[model samples]
Target: MMQKEWTTCFPFLNQMPDDERRRFLQSAVPHQLYAGEVVVREHSKCVGVVFVLSGELKVYKVSESGREVALYSVFPGEAALLTVNCMVAQETPVADVSLAAMQESLIAIIPSSAFFYLYSVSPQLQQFIFSCMYKKFNAIIDLVEKMTFKNVSERLYEYIRENTGSGRIPLYTTHAQLAARLGTSREVVTRCLKKMQRAGFLQTERGKISLLEKPEP
Candidate 1:
């Protein structure tokens, strides 16, 4: 019964043999995190592969200057690849790689030893992990290109378009959170957002942003 739920969220688990599946499921543990809670910290030991069963996780790295630059987000049915990398390499991440709950979240942790054993024998698990790596690698490349070539306003507008898939964006985060995601300061994000608002590009309300005009793609 419970196994069905985990396999539903992580379909790859369904491909495992009964023994391996039972072992893995028996070892995996679930945790709940409140919004704004920091779950993984810099230099902390890699605990296990984190599978988000519900809600969102933000993956970011902190700089020496106390700035945070978001790498990507982990949604339901997704795993945190950085944690997988760290666990595989058996090394503490040096770039201050961090993970936090962007909202109230329910996540499961597959113990490192169990994950390592399963990864060795489960081709399905390997495929899923590598697939995640490939997709996230491209996203990081895109972020780097934007940071290198695009101006702040252009980057911010691009972010808006990406998130506003339905032409409206729920204000799920604060200006500071936006800055971290955009690799900029809160003040810069605020100024750019205000400028966009004045330009009639969007309408900012208490908990949402409504697009008045869509940018030329």
Candidate 2:
């Protein structure tokens, strides 16, 4: 891959000096992941800073009951916050949540040491890293707030709408995936979805959910 062409799509790296950018590009290791592949597991050390060049991943936590709860979805141009934490701390950061590829993905993996070196020398990069930390922290806070206040049905609606927006119907996801995102059981999510379908709000088929009514954000 051409270094200049690849980094052009990434906003954070675009602000670096040419020499720094070249060095950083040289250090990156590209990785490809198929859907359902585990990117990182809970309590395991992060291998490197992962920058998603394309496709999606879900960051989530699993309870003792083996129920999975999604924390967030990471898209292209975003890096894992745990990786950044590891870079800043100069130690292998143990993950509290798991991450898995939601779709086939292209990712650029930068060693923590190389990232830290750039962070120290580039003020712009330092600020960008700090900004990433702030945004991810806020995202976690938002997730907590939503889960605490929102009912299962409402949360399911939000999740569907988030993925599909108002235009598309029949989002490609399983009931188990929806349950994970909503922090509920698959049975509960199925029940809620059925209710919505009956109420003319949505429809569910095998491996898909379609909105019958456009939901508010």
Candidate that scores best on TM-score:
1
RMSD of 2: 2.5
Per-residue alpha-carbon lDDT of model 1 for 1-217, expressed as tens digits? 3888889988988888999888888888989999989878877878788888999998998889999999889988888887887776645433248899999999989888899998999898899888888888898999899999999998987787768864555444577878999999989988998999988787777556666675564
Task: Give candidate 1 misplaced runs (Cα > 4 Å).
Answer: 91-96, 214-217
Give the per-residue lDDT of model 2 (tens digit) for 1-217: 5865566657667778988988888988998999989988888887678878889888888999899998888777677776666445545467767888999998888887787787789886777667767777888898898889988887788878877875375699888988887788999988888888877788777887777765454
Tell me the lDDT of model 1 at 44: 81
The stretch of ten residues in a row with the least summed lDDT in candidate 1 is 87-96
lDDT of 2 at 165: 73
Clashes per candidate, residues 3 or more apart or on different chains: 0, 1
lDDT of each: 0.84, 0.80
TM-scores of all predicted structures = 0.91, 0.90
